[model samples]
Target: MKKKLYLLGVFILCVVTLSGCIPTSEKKSDTLGLESTDRYELLIGLNDVGTGKQIMDTQEAIEIIKMKLLRHVSGVTITVSNGYYYVGAFIVDEATLNCVIYGADDESIAAVVNEINSDMNVSVLVSKTPSKYRLITP
Candidate 1:
């Protein structure tokens, strides 16, 4: 019986694997297209978790900001603050992106932040001490 069950499981696995081989629609440009082209591109806000205010300008704060932005932009695993990173329903601008950062090295974060900030409408807040930021529509 054990042998039979094992064979059944293997058969099921094979079926499942082979099912994925089925051909799918190759043309889905509309679904994968970028949907952003309007005014009020994006808004970035900073929040100081320690002071309970919106402020980002420290070593620790920068780390958190990068972590959050990377997740949203690159679809990587990341932790975000509550009520933060809210993407609104508006067409984003594809030029001169507006991003939010927290650190003395603003240029460094700008590179990465801008990557996610492009053609997107939202607000972001980055802070230190349990640092984090909130991205929302403005």
Candidate 2:
């Protein structure tokens, strides 16, 4: 009886110890050239809609755009300089800059864009790049 009880305790201890080694999430392989689908870069440029110059201040426009973007993406990096905007975000497949900047059917994205457009008369140029392509930041 003593020998059976001792063996049972040892088995339970081993099972508990090994269970901790299991991973909770899928691990990425170290294979070279593995592409990441979740990375993207967004560039936005503000320019005069017509022959006249842009009336809104460049810095203020940048801040307004930044705040709107933050509402959709959590860990986005946004910077603006000389009427140009740069945004870097991960896991941003659904919430795209073009969708947010240009009015889209998506309610969340459209709301932000419409608000900005209504306040400013400047035209916007939006560009999106995949993760493989590197963007030149200012």
Candidate 3:
């Protein structure tokens, strides 16, 4: 009986010790490249939609657009300049997709022309402005 009990305890100790020694998985994911985010830095020139004259050259404008786009995400800071805008959006692993709108809260480009949307593209109205400028992601 003593031998059996001693063997059982040793087995239990080995199992416990070996379990802690196992290595954990360190896997990453790749879905949408846009979703992963980058040290993204792009410039959007503010030219008059009509005359093509430069209206504003500002990092502030870029910062505003960056903040508006990534307000709900984590680990992002946008810098704007007079000549162009700079963006570095870092999405946390927990972020989820949602339609985000900013500015006069209008779904129109008039509310936010000369601005860059999340697709990292410039947004301009072809005709009369819509109700608001919106960013939608899957």
Candidate 4:
């Protein structure tokens, strides 16, 4: 009886996984492809996180960046990385932070990334985030 129950559980797990019943934490692009236009993402580093020789307070950096980006652009989405970065969202933490900025046009994205990288404590890595892979999550 125990063996049969274990097999049932395994079968249920496979069904759920194959049927796409599992949920993922990463926010997704729009289902309608409204944000299908060209958008970019900026992977940001700061202080030691920025340049190898630089130094900074992580929280302070996040605040400064949030304010600066907020002023220049209203549509940008910024997520703080826990001293590391992934392609998309994850559970946040209190440790040193990195940043990802996405969902904007080429010119706007370039302008903001340049603005942030111009700061002595920050450096920016530019990459095209395909709208299909990650755009405005619905």
TM-score per candidate, in order? 0.21, 0.39, 0.27, 0.49
Alpha-carbon local distance difference test for all models: 0.42, 0.50, 0.41, 0.60
Query: What is the TM-score (0 to 1) of candidate 1?
Result: 0.21
Report how far residue 7 has shifted in candidate 1, in Å.
Answer: 99
Local distance difference test, candidate 4? 0.60
lDDT of 4 at 21: 70
Which candidate would rank higher by TM-score, 1 or 3?
A: 3
Q: What C-alpha lDDT does candidate 2 achieve relative to the native structure?
A: 0.50
Which residue runs of candidate 4 sit more than 4 Å off their true CA positions?
Answer: 1-33, 48-54, 82-103, 132-138
Q: How many residue pairs clash in each candidate?
A: 15, 0, 16, 1
lDDT of 1 by residue, 8-125 (tens): 9999999999999988778656543444311111234344324434444434444654565554443222332334333386432211113332322444444555653442222443
* Model 2, span 32-113: residue lDDT tens: 5444333433444454445344555666766777877667554356555443333365221111123222222245444545
RMSD of each: 16.8, 14.5, 15.3, 12.7
Candidate 1 stretches with Cα past 4 Å from truth are 1-77, 84-104, 128-138
- lDDT (tens digit, per residue) of candidate 3 on 4-87: 999999999999999999987876543423232122223344444344344443444455555654543333333333433333
The total of clashing pairs for model 1 equals: 15
